[model samples]
Target: MNDATTSPADSALATRGAALDLLFNVLAKRVPFDDAWDASRPLRALEPRDRAFVRMLVATTLRRLGQIDAAIQGSLNKQGQQLKAVVQDILRLGAAQLLFLGTPAHAAVDTAVELAVARKQHPYKGLINAVLRRLDRERASILAEQDAGRLNTPDWLWLSWRKTYGTALTRAIVETHLGEAPLDITVKANAAAWAERLEATVLPTGSLRRAAGGQVTELSGFDEGGWWVQDAAAAIPARLFGDLAGRDAIDLCAAPGGKTAQLAAAGAQVIAVDRSEKRLVRLSENMARLGLGARVTTVAADATEWRPDAVVDAVLLDAPCSATGTIRRHPDVARLKSEEDVEKLGRIQSRLLYRAVDMLKPGGTLVYCTCSLQAEEGESQITNLLYRRPEMQVVPVTADEVGGLSELLTPDGYVRCTPGHLAEIGGMDGFFAARLRRVG
Candidate 1:
């Protein structure tokens, strides 16, 4: 409710307060941060630089909420016990700027106090000023002492990863999410050429990796559809069906059409099926932009209920799961998702995988994958399906097929790409995929 003032100082303070409004929208109201940001009237009215700052403020706070809260509580000593909610929000925002974002200490403190006054919590101005000043002085020591990986991660997710991946590797996954995710693009063709043109580094899997910061639309190959943004791990499932030229491949649960585009680009007659018509619109538009719309038949229907008139040669079942693996890109996954949701999603994934299997032709390949760290959603589902379907059997993914990223392959021949796998080359999303064939 802060009024914007003409002075630069008041404007900066108002923008920071607006960032807090976004944070409250997410943490208090349970709104997804992206949705909140998109609908933010205040943010939309800002200049480009201020808009970017608002985004950074909110994202950095969410990404480091645990750390910021810990730092604030530590600074408050016993006085923190009865702090007002608005006061807490202001302090958290201030600490994020000072400890993590490297904002000038005086500016951070000044703006935070100003934010408190504007929020009508004028009584807490001195408390906000004192706590933030103290935090700035002890920021280094506080940071060193705290386990930010544990702090930033939700308790449930942290425990799940620790139980699933063990202590050290789970720590690595948590640590990875703290940093910004890099941008990786799947080119239409000539991966090397596109990489050179975009000034990016080509990953072993052939996806191009560029620096983490930028406007994706401004990139060289975006408008021409020469390439599309696809994570290195995500780009793998479609590639599993190597040389799809002339093959009829169905991408079940396909939306936003990255894999569909890849299948079409590979010369496959692609039928992209998804339940959400809204997302299919996006997929259709993306296909049009890439000039691959002709090959892609967009089907807006549920994969479990929609049957192809005839069995297809290959199927890519990117079944929806908890999406825990994509935490690096969507920090909301850690905040918004829960254990019960994972259980529910696991069931849905099972149903979809079953349907995808039924649509596969005799000797056709079915590549089942999920961007999930839980075995119940990934490996366990595959095990259950194989036990139930006598005709279905595992078709091992090869290191040669996946650009010699052999480290991602499991003993049973599934590809399990994790954030820990390619540490030196940024990292890939955590994904579990099994290639299957109908032997009967």
Candidate 2:
């Protein structure tokens, strides 16, 4: 009998199970799982449940990587850093299911053993089974005594948070990321109409937050081009433009077009520019879906090397940074980012801001934003730019612009949102945004 004629459900299970394994492999190599999601081909055909399972596996493993490794080490007699990558990934996945997820002990061990056999790593399956069984027996004491910070995060990151936000706030921030993030949607035109149509709760900033799991494209009004998925915090910088109807706007580094969609929806003639041809494909698709293609023009060029045909009325530079702010949504961020990487990203952010200011028309707004929690990337970057460019004036965002988030706004009128700030209401991502005007 030909294996190709197998039942569809069996084939799907095999594919999804393999994708989960691949996801774990990529994550064990320290590559970010979400960014890897865009690159991995195995996950493309997975059902939503399996996809969610794979995501949960990668996220829980990364969130508790330190603790998971500790648990593995504690259970092993001969712990070596040079273990085979496949073996390591299998052990981590099994441990994650056994300890973090409520997966039954037998299912976790048996499935992991089957996976190991399929991958030709059977000699170590016994090792995997023994370790996981021990984890089950010691679950209560192991979890009770685990240091929250050390178990959940790297020592340097936990220490940095402690120094920056104090112990209580830092603990809250970590706890917030431990939970899943809600899906926030930005409506195209009428918020009330879309909210009613989709049965989603309308947030104060006009974004919609769904409970947790659902088919996004199948949601009501998605096919009608009613709205797009965007975090409430991510929508703020574009809204700072207020009324941009018929105005020319430039969105720098605008691939995958969340901010570009916001600008085009506001009636701005937007030129969305980014360096990557691959990412621009997704941006083009998003614009087509929303029927905003006419208002937005896609350009493939580096912001540093490309110049606009003419200065625009406004420019929004969503500069790249360490992206620590979005850890709740993309938990892989904490595992992949290092302190040295932040310093390098800060330099790039400074360069992007310098080029953005030069490309702005006089009296035009320049909104600078980043999904980073560090002061070096937010306040200090803006402060340094202010000294270098005397012609630019800090255009403070008003209470009306932030829509009841005025307290989160800095005294200088910049918006500074942290994970700890919105902890009670499902927690918001950390983002910093500042609007400036070119006066000369």
Candidate 3:
């Protein structure tokens, strides 16, 4: 089903076929890319190398979908618009190969045409072949005129970011999203020692950094549970509560438990609350791997309604948001998330925050955080909370609290880690955390 160069037996055809299905699902059906990726039977059947190819092909197509479509429209003379959605994705995948992955033109064009046949898209094979060939030929010019950062970013997000961080920084954030993020991991202790052993660079926030795209399980520390994968920015919010030893801490919305691990590792008597029971099981499994299960308890209930036996020392609400901040790693978020989604999540985050405060001790700390680049979900939520709850005063994050990076601190004393904050050393995810003290 593929060309001689690609080999009839090579996984190229199977991989692209899977990519098309996943892409069609994500773009047309509005299914999340990760969900689709996980549920894809064909994807699961491939060898790891081919699986990685499928992932990169689909991810690259999603990331540059704007430019790919623009190039397609240009090549199609508006005629290709009549092509089937899957066929369109086929062309998009082909364009991604030619322009981004540096796939050979013959292989890229041939496989695309062949892919159409394999998928019963034979009628549009001509269109697919023509469009991809044109893209391959004009690849240089197509790239030359493209404002990838602008083109790839959704209109709502581009404007929202401009208003929030101004043009230059917004551009930086968009630029950061155009590429893949490096792998960052948080260790239980002796991060420096782990860094030396793994030959990984220790980021300023003390997270270890290495080139991403390897099987995480294959890493040295996976078996020992010495470290777990986490973004440098994600490891920060939990640290805002300093000296958690023997203090009570609640990690609301804590599923898949990255922040929960940090809290328990800090010696906090942690109650990790999440809305999903299934995810709680996963969190418990992770804590066990980290040898932190004894220090943490999992609660599979709505954090707003689930209170501890007594008001705890601190609460960390890593509330759900549109997740625009993770665009670098999950480029599909740029295509999947909307301004309306941000508005909706902001309401939920606020509700969760109000409840988290109720569970805090009189002099306890409450750190509200979100992995959202939208101010509505981060800064605005905190602002409104302070207005409604007078007792919840901002304790303010100092430079030392976040690796002496004073730029991470807001004038109002919150911690705002944008993708552009640590751009020099492979930027971190965008995270907003505000430490508050309930002293009524």
Go through the candidates in order and give each one's C-alpha lDDT.
Answer: 0.87, 0.82, 0.88
Which digits, one per residue and each the tens of the lDDT, describe model 1 over residues 14-103?
A: 689789888888878888878898888887667788888888888888889889888887877584587777788888889989998999
Given candidate 2, what's the lDDT at residue 20? 56
**What does the lDDT read for residue 181 in candidate 3?**
93
Each prediction's Cα RMSD? 2.2, 2.9, 2.3
Q: Write the per-residue lDDT of candidate 2 for residues 55-160, one digit (tens) a residue.
A: 7777777777777888888888777545677777777777888888987887777777777787888788888788889888887787787775557777767887
Q: By TM-score, how accurate is candidate 1? A: 0.95
Best-performing candidate as measured by lDDT? 3
Model 3 clashing residue pairs (backbone):
none
Q: List ranges where model 2 is wrong by over 4 Å.
A: 1-25, 38-51, 77-84
Q: What is the lDDT of residue 317 in candidate 3?
A: 90
**lDDT: the better of candidates 1 and 3:** 3
**Whole-model lDDT, model 2:** 0.82
TM of each candidate vs. truth = 0.95, 0.91, 0.96
